[model samples]
Structures are given as C-alpha cells and as structure tokens.
Target: MKALLMLLPLTLASCMAGPDAATRAATAPQADAAVTISSTTLSRQHWQLRDAVDGSNRRLDALLGLPDKPLQLDFSADRISVSNACNRISGSYRIVEGHLVTTQLLQTRMACADPTLTQRDTTITTVLQGGPTLILSSAGHTPLLTLADANGRTLTFAGMPAADAHPGDDGDTAPQQP
Candidate 1:
C-alpha cells in the first residue's frame, strides 16, 4: 500500500506536468498562425504616428496641437526612440511572441510652455511605459503598427520604408529632426 501511494503521487505529478506532445502538436498550427514580427521587419522603417485614442476618445488632433508635427517612433535592433513633438524619449524594446515590449525608457527633461504639449508628452510616455502589445498589420499598401494598451487606449502609426527612412541615421539617435 505504501509503494502504491508513492506511485500515485508520481503519476499525479506527471499528469500535472502540462500538455503532452499530442496536445502541443494539435495546437501547433494555431500558434503558428500568429505571425511573429521579425526584427528586420521592425527595423526596416521609420514609423510615424497617424492616430491615437484614449479609451473611446480621439486624442490625435489634440496631441498634435497647432502646426501639427507628427510623433515618430523609430526602432533599431534593440532600442526605440520616440519624437514626441517637443521632447524625445528613448528606450529598449524587445519582441516576444508577436508582441513588442518596451523597457528602460529615458526621456529628455525639456519643459514646454504649452499645456497641450505637456499633456501629450505625458500621454505618450504613459502609453509607452504601459508596455502595450503591438499589432503589426497592413492597410492597403501601408504598413501599420498598432500599440494597444491594457486600458483599451491605442496608438497607430504608419511605416515609411527603409529606402525612405531618414538619411545618415539609424534609430539610436534621440530627437532627429522630422
């Protein structure tokens, strides 16, 4: 009876070891259906912010303010730089399982007189710091990068091809003129 009890625990442990090979194989195709965005794909362009939404509210126009300088996110091999109109934000980012994860953000300490620009800066930093999941897709001929936050806020950007990317620059530099 003692030997049987010991064997029973071992059996239960094995059962709790998670999905077996057969189960994994059955779901392999479904998992593969989620196309992973490669570093090459991400690094191949400069992404310009097209629109931003906070919950159900459209915040792009307000974020852009007067004269309308577009916000830009540039991704290199391991770093991300954001041109948030007035101040620049830089960070390290990684893609895992088709999601972009950002960390170690460093932003310039420039003070803006305009309250709207200040608010926009705060909003951009908040969204980036949230480590939103990126959805990489295409709209017609344009490549799109969508950062979706946990609170349902989303920022969408349009990608300009590597050929059209800024001359004499990679994405590592903070605040390159747009």
Candidate 2:
C-alpha cells in the first residue's frame, strides 16, 4: 500500500532520532559523577604549559619562545593566576556546563623589553580571553589539562599538586635563591 510505504520511512526516521530526553535524564547522574571526578582532579592541582597549537594545528613552540622560567597556572576557589614568564595574570573563573569560563582577567603592567616574552604573554592572554573548553585527563601517571578554543587551537598543560607550585605564596615573587 502507498500509505504503508510512506509511514515506513517516518518510522525509520524516528528510530534514528537518538536517545530522547527521558533517556538522557536517566543517565545524567552518571554524567554528573564523571564531571565531579574531573572537577576534583583539576581543583587539586597547579598546571604548567606542556605545549600549544594554533588554529591551524601547527605547533606554536617557535612563537612561544624559550621559557626562561616555568609558565604556570594556579586555580583557587574563585580565581586563576597565570605566570607567563615575565608577567602575572589573574582572573575569576567558574565551571558551567562542564566548561571553564574566565572573567575579570587582570594582568601585571610591568613592561618587558624582550620581544619574545612580550609576544608569548600576548598569545597567552588571547587564548585565555577566548574561553576555551577544558578537558582534563591523565597520561600514564601525569594529569593533563587541554584547553581547546572554538577555532580549534589547543593548549595542553601538565599538572602537579597545588602545594608544589612555583613562586611564593602570592604567586608573584620567585622563590629566593639559596
């Protein structure tokens, strides 16, 4: 029958519609558990840049320049502080729908004469301003943080316990040399 043939396609389409709201709701608890695990992992650590890639997926090592000191990120209950070689940047951040959104970012005004340091700092600020999606995972025994922007650029970081982060209590002064 012609009517039956037409209805057959409609039925098949509905079958391919994927999981409905009820099914998603039923599995939300599991998803929430995973998110909680990830949040705990990230919150307990301080992270440092491992590598960076541009929107074209090209490695940005040349542009980033050689680091004279470790670049770092420290996360607290409400703020993130960044030490990008020569300058310090801080901002408030919140996790929403599994994404880290940074707001009210502030950076030190100290002028750096080194072009390389200035360029690297500018790139870091630009990436942070884009509100990249955060992905936390582990490789071997090391924790990794990957921040991917909407344009496909990614910055990967390796993390250590917050207690081991460099610089002093204020995250501005370098540790005094013996």
Candidate 3:
C-alpha cells in the first residue's frame, strides 16, 4: 500500500505520456547503436543496477547513495522514479543536448537505518542532476541501460521486462515493492 502511494504520481504521469519520447541513448554493440528510444521503450522494463563504475573501472556499488539494495529505476512518460533509495526519489526527466537530465527531484522524508544511505542522497541527486550521457544497448537477450556522467562515473542498469522477470530472478537479495 505504501509503495502504491509512492508510485501513484508515476502512474498518472504515464497516462499523460507520449507514444514516444525523443530517440537516442548512446553507443551500442555496433548494430544496435541506431536503436530507437522512446518513452515507451524506456518504460518497457524495470532497470536494475548491474554495475557502477568510474572511467578507471573502479566499482562503486558500496556508495550507491541509497539503501543497501539493488537500485531500480522506473520511467513514466516524462518522469523517473527511483527505488532502493530508502525514501522515494522521483522527478521529471528529459533529454537535453543528448544527455539524460533530471529536474525537480523530490524525495520522501522517511529515515533510513543506514547513515551512509541517508547522507548520500546528495550524491545521487547530484549525479542525476548532472545530465549524464544515456546509453542503451543489449547483451544477447537482455537489454542494458547505461548513464555516464561527465566525471566518467557510470551507472549501468540491466533491463528486466515485467512479464519476464520474477521477484528473485536475478539474485535480488532485497526486493523492492512497486
């Protein structure tokens, strides 16, 4: 019930979404670079954090800037909601100058058990607000979404279509409610 309340705005926004959003994410495996990206395409799956790294390939998942759980991103027509943030994080998003930009970010005031998580909201907020480069591609059968900031840090997500993904399908230790 609580989760539903958090998602209500996203649901409403999606109802107002366009059939498509401006296309383009980033480089892919040669052939898929030209793949089209629409609001519909983006909202098609539940993107889970697969890896977080820097240009040096240093893993940064420990500083996920949220609760100790897999980070999940959901897209509506023009809005994006973040899960595993302890509190809900959402806002309007758009493509500007070939980058994914998030604005008007709002987060619930719910407290988190981990001080590290709570204190790092600024980290994630800063990243999202930085207008990171968006890249979408696929590996075999699964879709991959990547967001890279100017600082060379990246957040890559693995797409899991709602119809094809189960609660524990990809070794989810902490499952977030929708």
Candidate 4:
C-alpha cells in the first residue's frame, strides 16, 4: 500500500511537469497535414470586426466604431486596408511565418468630430502596428480571422462573402484599396 502511495505522487508530479507526449504531437503537424497559408488566401476574402478585447479580455466596444457602421479589414495584393467611421487606413502588409508584418499604417488626415470614432482609430492602430499572429479558421458557417496582437489583444473578425461585402458592386468593377 505504501509503494502504491509513493508511485501516485510521482505520477502526478510527472503530469504536472509539462504537457504529455500526446499533447505535443497534437500541436505539431502530422506527416500528411499541410499547414502553410498563402498570403493571397486573404486577398479574396472580406472581414468585419466582430469582437475586440484587451489583454485582460475586457470588451473594447469603443474600437467598434459607430453602431450603424462596421470596422472592416480588407486585404489586397500587398496592402492591408482598414475602413472605419472616421478614416481610411492602409499599409504595406505581409504574412510572414504566421505573423502579420506591416509598415506603419497611413491614415487620412480628416478629424473626426465624434470622440468614439477618434478613439477607434487609435485603438485599431495600437492592435495592428505590432506584428500579430494571424489565425484563419473556416469551421463555422462564416470563416473567422483572429489576430493576436503584441499588446496581448485578440481581435476576432467574421468573414463576409465578397459578393455580399460589396453589395453595390457591378460584376465588372472591383473595390479599390487605400
């Protein structure tokens, strides 16, 4: 009975030391699994911000812009564009090794009269300037784009169908990026 008690503690200690072999294997790609994501994959999709939270997981609805308008992110061949209630923001962007690398964002000079709108611009800049990890998941009906920024904020965006995203578009015309 004493030997069994001693072994129980040892087993628990080993489990607590770190992840088990199975856990490590699950995190890594298997022989047949392909994991590389091409930057162009995002170019065809339109994304709208659905949730924003800081490191503490506090809801930052202020970054959401006005209730009537959505804060949108559009990916182009070599640019990342952000459209909000107040300004049009764009920057050169690249998805390097699963991280979002970008030049400093360039936004229009228009001054927003609304305080929340102004704050939204600043908040978006904060989360995007630092290289963030980009994760795209298509498990749900609508695809999801998650950005985990260096400031520890997680921004979750829901994918919109290109056709649905630009309802007014004639098939021959495409939206221009900032």
Candidate 5:
C-alpha cells in the first residue's frame, strides 16, 4: 500500500510537469520545434491586415502602402522594422502559433492627414486581442498579408486604406539600418 501511494504521487508529478499529448498537439511549436519560424522565415512571410469585417479599417490602411517596391521587413531577435512606401516603423513583435502580437510601435512622425494610417494603427492594436492567423501570399500585384484563422478564413474588418500612399513617407524615410 505504501509503495502504491508513493508511485501515485510520482505519476501525478510527472503528468503535471509538462504538456500532455493533446496539449502539445494544440499548442504553437516552440522555438526548438521544426515548426518554429526563424526571423528570416517570418520576414519572408506575406501578411495583411484582417479585412473590414474583421476590423480591417483605417489603421491597417496606414500601415501598408502600394507595393510599388517590395515592402522590406527586417525581423530581429525581438523587434520588427517595416519599410512601407511612406514611413519606416519599428515595434516589438511576438508570434504564437500563427498569431502575431506587435506592441509599443514607434513610427516616424511625419504629417499625413490620411486618416487611414491612424485608423490602421488603432485597428492593429485592437485586433491583437483577437487571435488571427498570419499567412504570407504573393499572388497579387502586391504581397498579400492575410490574417486568418486556423481554418484559413481571413477575418473581415472595415476601412482599408486605398492603395495610394507610401508607408515610409515620413522624414525618417531612409533605408533601414542593419
């Protein structure tokens, strides 16, 4: 009886120490797993804001511009730099499964009354609360960044900026540094 009781505690402890099979299957691949994405991989992935139905409004518009030049995304150990046609924006980013969270974004403050950029920023910040799948697609004239779900459905949002402006139009619109 004493030996059985001791074994029971050991079994329980082991079970509690790490994820179970189901948990592992459901969770995002960790940094080590082959499924994990490297900075190079993430930079290469095509992503777009969710659609208007999913809050793809003014903010998403301002963040991305016409694809005249391929948008340059420099992914670092903990931060991201995107060279939109008008401005250079940098922020901290994290990925879970297929979802990405960008925080504390600091953009070069140039005067563009284009409401879309402001709105796009707001939308991006708000939608981070809702999980969205990150998909990279290059089928269109511009690279398409699809924010979808596990089932591969793009979340519909509102207020996409017209493909008029460049992202790096701000005073700091220079080539990004290494």
Candidate 6:
C-alpha cells in the first residue's frame, strides 16, 4: 500500500515535468533577413519606434524631439502609406536585397509652423535607407515605434496618434452609453 502511494506521486510528477504547449510552439523557424513583408496583416502589425542611438549621440531624437503624433504604417507591394497626425504620406518603395528604399514621398500640404514634423520626415527617410531588414519592438505602453538593425542595433523611430478624422464632432466626447 505504501509503494502504491509513492508510485502515484511519481507518475504525476513525471507527467508535469514535460514542457508546456506554449513553449513547444515557439520552436518554429525564426524570421530570416530576407523575409519579405507583403501581406496586409503583416504590414499592419504594430511597430513601436525606438530611439536611434549612434555611439553617444541621439541625432533623430534631437531633431524631432520625440513623436507627438500617432501614425499608421500601411505597406503594399510597391508603396507604403503613413496616415494620422494631420499628414497622409504615401510613396513608392523598393527592397534591394533586404534593404528598403523609398522614393517620391508625397505628403499632405497642410502647413505647420512646427519644425518637428519636417525633422521626423527626414528621420524616417534616413532609417528606411538602411534596408527593410529592420527589427521593431513595442515602446512601453505608448503607441510609439522602434526600429532596429540585423545585428539588433536600434535605429530612430517614433509613434504618433492618427489624425482626428471622425465623422461627427471628432473624438471630443466620450461615447454615449447603450
């Protein structure tokens, strides 16, 4: 009877010793540098920007002073769209090897005395020049964006709120209760 009791605990412990199902699922192949981001779901994946730091200098952050806007990145086969923050910029893009190159970037002509937007535009252009093999991560709880290199070196990026384009009085009041 004592041996039976001990054997019951031993069997239960052995069953629990194996890995959980979640751990085993992540054993899939890692994304390679050459993986092309083509589909809409892949393009709309949330990307929080990380500050691009070079040595001890913060060039992009110094220029734009962090993003005050929420932006959406919508990419297709040959073009990329950036909406929100009072600007809807679209342009053609090409991937060379694993790098992303953008050209003919045209944005809405709404005038803003703030120089930050221009600086941000420059920052985005420069980062994309490093190719499309960029790594992205969440920036805390903010909708911010972060970009990194193949070797895990982070580049400069920012997240901003999309422009207020609601049909009614904009996003001013809370939703009415049911």
Best candidate, lDDT:
4
- What would you estimate as the lDDT of candidate 1? 0.74
Candidate 5 per-residue lDDT, tens place, 65-167, comes to 4434333445555676654424457788888766767786677766656555555444444444345665543333444455554333343322222334333
Greater lDDT among 1 and 6 belongs to: 1
Per-candidate TM-scores read 0.67, 0.67, 0.66, 0.72, 0.40, 0.46
Deviating ranges (above 4 Å) for candidate 2: 1-40, 62-64, 164-178
lDDT of 4 at 171: 35
* TM-score (C-alpha) between model 2 and the true structure: 0.67
How much does each candidate deviate from the true structure in C-alpha RMSD? 9.0, 8.4, 19.9, 7.3, 11.8, 11.6
TM-score of 1: 0.67
Q: By TM-score, how accurate is candidate 4?
A: 0.72
Per-candidate Cα lDDT values, in order, are: 0.74, 0.70, 0.73, 0.75, 0.49, 0.50
Best of the candidates, TM-score: 4
Candidate 4: tens digits of C-alpha lDDT, residues 73-147: 888768989887478889998888788888989999898888877877887777788888887765446667888
Instruction: Summarize candidate 3's per-residue lDDT along 54-117 as a digit string, tens digits.
Output: 7788987565554336678888779998877667899999877558888879999987787656
| Pairs clashing within candidate 1 | none
Model 2: weakest 10-residue lDDT segment is 29-38
Clash number for each model: 0, 0, 1, 0, 32, 20
